[model samples]
Target: MVLEGVYKVRSIDEVVELLEKYRENAKIIAGGTDIVIALRNEKITPKVLIDISSIDELKSIKDEGEFIKIGAGVTFTKIVESSLFQKNLWGLYKACRLVGSPQIRNKGTIGGNIANGSSAADSIPPLICLGSTITLASKNGKRKVLLEEYYKDKANYGMKEDELLVSIDFKKPTENRVLSFAKLGLRKALAISRISIATFLELDKKGQVTTIRVASGSLGKYPMRELEVEEFLCGKKLNERTIDEAIKVVQQSMDERLKGRSTLPYKRVAVESMLRESIGDGIKFLDGVRA
Candidate 1:
């Protein structure tokens, strides 16, 4: 792998100091799930490895006032076992639970998932639905990048070479807001997501959509907000008629985005079940709570 030194950092300041010294020559390693693969494959050759697993601050999940702050070094297995991810944030829990297999989940960090920049990253779709932001730190200071925008031009807009992604945070969905996720994989075990959908929704007392976010994975170059479908569903009551209409809008968006790709027809058809599962389950959960 052509690595010279592996500095096990105890704090963010130490990590930043190392990054400042090594700059682009250094690569941060946590969980080591994705980076190790890259190192072995010779896809990335870094002279220095800054390991952040020893930093306790980067492994905690904090409930800060109205937001949930998850440390970058936190593993997917940790999220699956956390009580904070229940109820309104269950979609995130589901996403983490379905990541790779139990062994991968134990070693895979959400930060690594985002840093990996895979188009089919499962955790990203639900994070996008939650409108999350990632914190990147350097010697100078910290910068916050919206999760949705980071994926847009990952080569350039993603974490800079001199920065370390520290944590991801988003507003805590209220009791009235429900988040749900549905994924289609080739098989039940060790299946990579072929198509996945996440929906975060809140309906008013009148049973009309007030806030809704839809996001998809493997449906585009990166997991992203389904803005057209969200726009179509806003203010509309959740029912068969509106859902059917929304599915049509999703298909049209895919048609425009894919532009005759061979996967277009398959994706168009597959997306419907994903939408129904996430959106319909979210509504039913809220409905059951009321009942």
Candidate 2:
């Protein structure tokens, strides 16, 4: 039942204090895009609505030494519009650009994307590929977890009800990093992805590919890094045979849960093409064929 509970709080400290006081009864709201729907569907019924949307500290993105720290309130629209972010993090920018329509992008945030942890989320795969970290905060203190390790137990990971996801920190890519993000959805816009992929490749001064990370979303119970595929590509040259070998490695690593999904047939074929195209784009970037 949608009973009228008095919505409360206007600041981060107030929200934190209320959460510390109410714990499981208090819920944080950023854009409330997903949460509102969950509430409408009777999936959750928090006694207190602590609006952190007004909190200034949680709405900025900045450089913090080796990482780019994106506050919880930073919207997808801002990500797509930022010149610095686009220049340095092409995969992330591309992912951001594909998120929802203009209205949704303006209201949806990176932190909200992470907190929701939905398998079909556009931003999570790239974040996982970039080796991001999430900062979860509460009145008690804060904890940081590697984005790749954040998901667990076939779709269940423990997060305290009182904790607020404060920020996501993506370690800046190494100089000359080649990254790509791709999604195949039912429609061009405002469509949940049937399959999505994110790839990152870093090469040494000698032109040998040193580090590779690939992650796939909407293909598992949780968005996951393709560690086995990445390991296989470590010393391999950027060539057709190597990319095909990497795709084979990806297919082998896919969990049975993914294989059982409805999109299996399309995804099986599409994912290989996505991987090939992404690796080709990476090679082009490395070879100075495109920026």
Candidate 3:
């Protein structure tokens, strides 16, 4: 792959400035895990490359009262090392831990993963279950969008040409809430996910589900919230019966969405176990917390 120019930007402002100048002719590179592959395959040909890997302001993780904010430049290794995620956000931690090999985790940025917008992206399903929002910045100002709505199509995310994604924010989960993730891949290590599920569940004192959010990856054109499963789980008790019913709802939806695909039969069966395991993990996490 060849580029006319490369700019190592140190701040978000510099990145936005370069984007404004180069517009569609420019592409942003952080970890380069995805972009490098795309460049090699000639899938993308950019006249200029704006590298935001060294931007200091985009690498910090902070607690902002009601929400926890993660800078876009923070790497998967950074996330796996954070006590905050290990202690509270285990779903996200687990996802990051399984992103790729150690070398890939060290180089891949969360921002890059989200920006790449692959259906198999590891971080997105969990982020969506957590009700995450992302901030897009440009010379004009910054705008926030729900992560679940960011993808307008399978191939295109809603980011503007002049906007750089700066940070992702999600409301801090309370003691009553639990989040969990499960994935099916071809192999145990460094395997691309074939299917995955993330579940966010809130339980009441009597052990009934008060609220529930279910999101999945590699199950559709893009990572998406499983609204039917969520609706069925809400206000219900997390028992074997409820879990079985939820699995059927998910299978029905998947069948309708991926009816003619070659992977449909396998995915339809695999997703049930993934969803079951994710929901079970969420319940177990909450149980351990209460204990």
Candidate 4:
């Protein structure tokens, strides 16, 4: 690849200043996992590469009392290693842990995964399920957008050509709430996700679903919240009958969303087991609490 200049920025201001100067002609590079390949293939040609890997402002994971904040430049390996994500937030941990191979995880940042804009990005569904929000910084100013809206309405909510994503944050769920995730891949080792599900749920004392957010990857034009399935699941208790019926609800939604797509048939069948793992685990955890 031909580059007029490469800059390793030390602060957020430096990154945005370069982005402001180069605008569409500049590209941000962190892990360089995906962008490097794109660069090599000439799929994207930018006159400048702004490296943010060394920016301390973009490499932290903090528990900010009411919510958790993660810098955009924090890598999957860092998320996997962070103790904050080991409990109720384990879904985020599992998704990051399962992204590609060890080498990729060590270098791939959560912000880059979303920026890559692949429908199959493993980190996204879980983050979406967590009701995450991302911040964008530019010479103009900084703005925070709901992560889901940013993905679905990119033309409107997406970062401008001169903006940089700074960090992502989400409120902390109740201590007993469960955020579970499961994915279907060619192999468990290093396969990219063919399909993935993440469920953030809380059950009432009598085991009825009180709150739930379900999201899936590779199920649409982008990774998004499965609102139809979530609507079907709420107020209903988790069980074989309810779960079976909920799976059918998912199929119905996909039928309309992916009508003529070739991958629909395979997703229709594989989702049963995938849903069982993502949602059923919450049931098991709640059951154990009652026992």
- Tell me how candidate 3 scores on lDDT: 0.90
Candidate 2 global TM-score: 0.91
On residues 1-291, what C-alpha lDDT tens digit does candidate 2 reach at each position?
334354445556676677788777767778888899988888998876777777788888898778789998899998888875664378788888988789999998888888888998889998988888888777888888887888854234446776788888877876688678888878988977767898888776665678888888877888988878888889867777888888877776664556676667777788898788667767667667323
Per-residue lDDT of candidate 3, residues 37-62 (tens digit): 99999999999999999899999999
- Reference-based lDDT, each prediction: 0.91, 0.79, 0.90, 0.91
**Which of the two candidates, 1 or 4, achieves a greater TM-score against the reference?**
4
For each candidate, how many residue pairs have backbone atoms clashing (under 3 Å)?
0, 0, 0, 0
List ranges where model 1 is wrong by over 4 Å.
Answer: 153-157
Q: Where is model 2 more than 4 Å wrong at Cα? A: 1-3, 6-8, 153-157, 205-207, 289-291
The TM-scores of all predictions, comma-separated, are 0.95, 0.91, 0.96, 0.97
Model 3 steric clash total: 0
Candidate 4, after superposition: displacement of residue 229 in Å?
1.1
Q: Which window of 10 residues has the lowest lDDT sum in candidate 4?
A: 282-291
Residue pairs clashing, model 2: none
Q: Mind giving the per-residue lDDT tens digits that candidate 4 earns over 1-291?
A: 368989988999998889988988999999999999999999999999999999998999999999999999999999999999877888899899899999999999998998887999999999999889999999889999999999899989977889899999999987768888999998988888999999999898888999999999988999999999899989988889999999999888888989999999999999889999999876776676567
If ranked by TM-score, best first, what sequence of candidates would result?
A: 4, 3, 1, 2
Badly placed stretches (over 4 Å) of model 3 are 152-157
**By TM-score, who's the top model here?**
4
Per lDDT, what order, best first?
A: 1, 4, 3, 2
